[model samples]
Target chain A: MSIQIEELCKRYGDKVLFEHLNLRVEKPAVLWAPSGWGKTTLLRILMGLEQPDGGRVTGVGRVGAVFQENRLCRALNAVQNVALVTPDGKGDPEAIRRDFGLLGMQGAALALPTARLSGGQKRRTALLRALWAEADTLLLDEPFTGLDPAAMQQAAALLRQRCAGRSALLATHDRAAIQALGWPVLVLAGQNGPESGGK
Target chain B: MKPVWVQRAAAVLFWLAVWQCAAMAVGQEVFLVSPVAALRALVQLLPTADFWGRVWFSSGRILLGFGLGAGCSVLLAAASAKIRWVDILLSPLMQLVKATPVASFIILALVWVRGRSLSILISFLMVLPVLYGAVRTGIQSTDPQLLEMARVFRLPRMRRLRAIWLPAVLPAFHQGCSVALGICWKSGVAAEVIGLPDGSIGDALYRAKITLSTGDLFAWTFVIICVSALFEKLFLWILDRAVKRVTGEEAAR
Candidate 1:
């Protein structure tokens, strides 16, 4: 089923974010927008973290995501973080450790707190967590932020493999990411008016 | 670099000097005992079998009370955090416990419990509010974003607790335990003194006070401080080690 948004309106006091907006997301998709375009707000609404002022959102399943922030448990390692979202009986700690290795994270690096990790390492941990979740729908909010070119390619491949035949909504500013994923893009530009910098 | 023992000795000497000066100014052994006299009294008491028994009796009850209070507080705080009704139900009780004087609790507990057990009840009461408040605040202050991630992932209760709640709350809980342990000892001894429990340090101190043995009083007080400090150090060391182990395993896995 597709996630359908109809007559959606969001306002923070007098400042309106979206008004009478409508969109339908089917299959794996991307919502490309620049910073401050309310991409996160929209995602939050879809995730039920925020309630839209006036609108309807439907067809959201068990959702997993790399949030705008990494949101990895700072005290837990990559394997533990990944295992947290894997289905209860399905989680394999060794498998997660192997996956981290495959993602180019050293065993020692994966054994440290996320606080001690570099930004890209933490990003990969967060990505792994989401990818390992038993969710029908995946949300990626600038999921490739901290990765270098090589890491970005590896992460993109990981996401592509995991998101195959599944619904995904990726919000990103990186045109390269959009091109890499090759998913249908819905430009959220000019939807919130000219003064509203979707970029 | 100075060794830790040297710094500790220096601190003890500094305090002893101040105490000696105060004792000299008082000019009466009945009113104030000198550190030297107190040390002599301590040496005399240390060899007695009764002294060891009293120490054990008091330490055991106080530690038991502290352990019970900590366990109950953690459980209650978790329940209250999860349920609004539980929070509402506990709010007034927590406030009452916080507001009530330790002496009042000791006196009240004496009517309901044996004199020997009075310290246990009093210490439990003193420790509860500290642990409850700290645990609740820790739970409340956990990052909502992380909790949201847990929800999205449908993390099980035990896993969620280990991964998110335990790490978030352990620091605050350990802090509360540190503070509450000190308070429990003080309040517990105070209760024992008032109740005059047999085979207890507080009873010995009470007897010393009645006999105008100021040196014995000072010696007993010193023992109490030492015991309290030792217990705090041991308990906190164990807690620190446990937290490190748990978080370390999580980090390693």
Candidate 2:
């Protein structure tokens, strides 16, 4: 399934963000934009968190997202955080634990509250949670911000593996991350047309 | 360690000296009973079975009322925070409860409730508005961004409560409970004294007052203060532990 955003327009007071914007997202697509281009706002609108002044979003189903902030429950462990979004309550917590280990989390660190985790660890946990949740659509905003290069590569691979057959709309500034995932890119520049790039 | 103990002993001796001087200046035991006489009276009362029964009876009822008030406050705060209608509905009642005096509540309650239950009802009433306001403000102060994240993820209500609401509400709730517990004990005891239930500490204190046994009155008053402090410490200790367990933050202590 694909998400079709048609004539999407959003504004804040006197500032016009985007007017008569159109985008089509098929399975496993990446939405790329520079800072301050309203990518997060657009994603939020699609998720029904923000209602656009004018827009129609179709083909969104049970969205899971890594918000710009690492919104992990400060009190819960990583496994419990992921389990919170899973409908069947059958999210493989052991696998999520292993993924956290692979992402350089270890020892009591994983068991510790997310509040105690370092910035990178919390970000990785949030990303993992979004990917692991049972959702047909995943919206990730800067899913690899605090990760080192190697960890970012691992995270990209993890995202690719977990998001198979699911539509993904990833917003990121890192060109290298965009290339590493090899996702078809939709670039927004200056509220004009979206520039398409390498798949 | 020795110096610390010596300092504490010196402090107690200093207070005793001051109290003895005050008692001597008064030239009457009725006005201000000496600490020595009060201690002697406490020792005499300690041997009686009725003392324990009085202590337990008052303590149990007041603690029960405090617990009920605290629990209901949490539930009501949650409901009020989630629904504007509930919040509007409860605002006037909370305001009225806060505005009313403890004595007034005790007097009004005497008409509707039996004398035995007066302390419990008064304590519950005294504590409820405090806990409700604290928990409500705590819930209101939660980060909007985190709630948005939870909404997007569609987290289960119980998980959201455990992970989000509980952590946000705990510190304020703990503070409220600490304050409310002290007030509950004070109001409870005052209500009991007014009502004069059969086997309660308040009844004993009332009897001491009637007989003008200044020593016994002072001793009973001291015991009440000690019990109230002890209850506050124990309840807050348990509450801190529960908050830490829920938020998974050991530093909550």
Candidate 3:
């Protein structure tokens, strides 16, 4: 499945965020943009959380997203948070535990409430939640925000393994992360709209 | 420094002392009863079968009313949040209930409801609007960011409810219940005093008033305060546990 955006336009009161932006997601890709370049807004629109000022996007079916903010339920533990997005909330405990362990989360960190988790742990929880969701497309916004270099590499590897054969877009400006994934890059250039590039 | 509970106990003793002095200065048993006299009256009443009977009679009916009110308010609040027409219809009615006086409702309800069920109906009415407002506000104010995440992930209805909605709304519900519990007891007993249901605590209170037994009045008032506080604590504790179980947070732990 592919997502196609046609002449999408969005703007604030005076500042324009997106102007005639167009892009496609036929494979997993990286959305590379400088800070304040409206990458988050584009992802929000794609996730159907916001309405575009003018344009059409098609083939964006059931979506899974890792928000800029780690949106894990504060009262739920890391495992429970991942299970929350599964169909009927019936994720297998063993598989989830193994996945957490792969991302360096185990024991007390996995069982404690997300509120008590460190920033890096929370980000991993958010990523795992999206990966576990029964969704057709994935939209990740700065998914490795607080991760250290080692954790970032682990998360990148996890994302690559889970996102295979699925339409995914990882929005980040981190050069190291962009190189880590080595996926096609869709750059959101201000005013000039988006420039598509391939690795 | 002493513990917080000890400080609170000291404060309570100081107030009791002030009350005792005031009662002695009045110098009339008909006008006032000292703390010791009220305690003595409480001790005398506790051993009697009738006292427990009256306590149970009032407590059971009032609690039933509270439970019913709580259930209906949650359902109605959800409906109001989901449907615009429901909110439009129920908003004014809830406002009117809040504005109307408890005594007026007790008197007006006397025409429609039997005397035995009067306290139950009164308590229900007293709790409904408060809880409805709290639940509605809670639902309305739920974090939009979390809601967006749920939608994007296509989380199922029940999962979204347990994970997102319950935690958002629980604090408000707890606050509402705290405020509603006291009103439920006060209005229920007032209804009983006015309706004079057979063998209710309010009936005894009415009898105490007619007989000019100030000690009985003080003793019954003390009992009401204690019971109300205890019920609030128990109800809130159960609510927290139930929410934890439903959300699978307890199982994860």
Winner on lDDT between 2 and 3 is: 3
Rank list by TM-score: 3, 2, 1
> How does chain A of every candidate compare to the true chain A by TM-score?
0.91, 0.93, 0.96
Residue B5 local lDDT, model 1 = 100
What pairs collide in candidate 3? Answer: none
Error of 2 at A160 (Å): 2.4
TM-score of every prediction relative to native: 0.87, 0.91, 0.92
Of 2 and 3, the candidate ahead on DockQ is 3
Specify the poorest-scoring 10-residue window by lDDT in model 3 chain B: B244-253
lDDT tens per residue, model 2, B183-212: 998999999999999999899999999999
Off by over 4 Å in 3: A7-22, A34-37, A53-55, A190-196, B248-253
Number of the predicted model whose TM-score against the real structure is largest: 3
Best by DockQ: 3
A100-139, model 2: which lDDT tens digit per residue? 8777776788787787788888898899788777787999
Model 1, span B22-62: residue lDDT tens? 99999899999999999999999999999999999999999
Native contacts, share recovered per candidate: 0.68, 0.74, 0.82
Deviation in Å, model 2, residue B127 alpha carbon:
0.5
